[model samples]
Target: MAKLQLITPNVAYEQDYKAFYQDWQDSGRAIIPSVAKDLPADFAGYVQRLNDNAQGIGLEEGIVPNSTFWLVNEENNEVLGAVNIRHQLTPYLERVGGHIGFGLRPTARGKGYAKTMLALSLKEAKSLELEKVLITCDVDNVTSEKTILKNGGRRSTDEQTEEGIIVHRFWIDL
Candidate 1:
């Protein structure tokens, strides 16, 4: 089984963050928000983005630490996928962003990593006293939809984002 590690932002991973952002962008996948190549190079902007994203959702406190989790092959420490849980939820989050955000890296697309990562995240969310959590994915992302449903996510409704993207929302009660 693959081991998943929840990581906090720190110096050791400063470069790893850059690399993951770069690799994901280069792989031509739609995961992290698109950043200008130069923005990642700008340390402050990069750090701020990361913090803002986590903080914006209240993932910064209550023993949760508002962090990101990396799914890895325990045997080799190979990074596969990641899921980030926010400490708090917002209106937008309720509609789409959800309480947890996850994605399978290009190299590990499939193999049930996404589902496992989310299941683990849900456990953590429950630990923080979250009775239920909302998770959303693009309507077209069948793989992610299935992963969520497999984790006991019940279908809610498709909401249209202000950006015009249709997002499928699911609610998972602990």
Candidate 2:
């Protein structure tokens, strides 16, 4: 529970980001916001990709423009977590991905960082002029469900992905 700030991905935080990435790798959980998965060796390139994604440049098929932010502990300069906010949703995203995807490092969990990180992401959503946002999580992921609920998310309906995963969808008014 350090002073947290959500920042756009940048080379200035390369080292911290590497460590954060490693932590997620070590946890053996699928990285939330698939954009954060399989990071390239070039940290600069990765940062640039995140920037490009925000600008709707060089996006892969079916991918929409999105903003990615790192939640950092300002006091210690540690990368605590990340959040990806999609500017618009595709059919698949509407059903499973939602507008916001976020996660904290294993070491940062259970310290109230997720809630704060999500609150900040909601602010970013509002800045994007979104009237509301869809946020989804695994139906079994109680922690995330709680976070979404605390953030004023209203339960919509559960969706089953093609992969057969049950996803809980919620909407928050901006």
Candidate 3:
């Protein structure tokens, strides 16, 4: 197995990213970390958007500045997954969205990649000067719950969304 590294979104990884995107699409599941959803047709533009979002440039309503990273296998150059780290949280985020959101390609699931992806993301969160971060997963997402626990996340509470979806919330002290 190749070691994985987290990288910022860039045009250089366009092909690998497209494959990663397709894998999620083919899974017929709702993409996580909203940032990875609805990629624009123009790859370059999509990359630019991610970069701009990180810098708090031209943000949309209700959006906070966030950094997005691609988890890649350096040897094979495959984009295995992605993580989005929000610099700050809003009321909604405090309730459910949380500060960190991440997902792996369908084929990459259940192989400990999520743990590494998250551990790496926390480093990025620390670099952003975040002392602590909130992470949330669906109440039924056992895999995520375990991953969070492995990363030193302490269960704080569980929140129910307006739509009545139960979400488990954990806090990681960075």
Q: Write the per-residue lDDT of candidate 1 for residues 1-174, one digit (tens) a residue.
A: 566665444444555555655667779766642222243456665555555655554433333335555555656555566667767776666667778878766767767677778888888788768899888888888888898999999988566564777888899999
Candidate number of the best lDDT = 3
Q: Count the backbone clashes (under 3 Å) in each candidate.
A: 4, 0, 0
| lDDT assessment of candidate 3 | 0.92
lDDT of 2 by residue, 32-100 (tens): 767788778888999999999999999999889999999999998899999999999999888888899
Clashing pairs in model 3, backbone N/Cα/C closer than 3 A:
none
| Candidate 1 colliding pairs | 58-87, 58-88, 59-66, 59-87
Q: Which stretches of candidate 1 lie over 4 Å from their true place?
A: 9-19, 33-65
Query: Which sections of candidate 3 miss by over 4 Å?
Result: none
Better of 2 and 3 by lDDT: 3
Which RMSD values do the candidates have, in order? 4.7, 1.1, 1.0
Tell me how far candidate 3 lies from the true structure as C-alpha RMSD in angstroms: 1.0
Give the TM-score comparing model 1 with the true structure, all chains together. Answer: 0.74
**By summed lDDT, which 10 consecutive residues of candidate 1 come out lowest?**
32-41
Clashing pairs in 2: none
lDDT score for residue 21 of model 2: 87
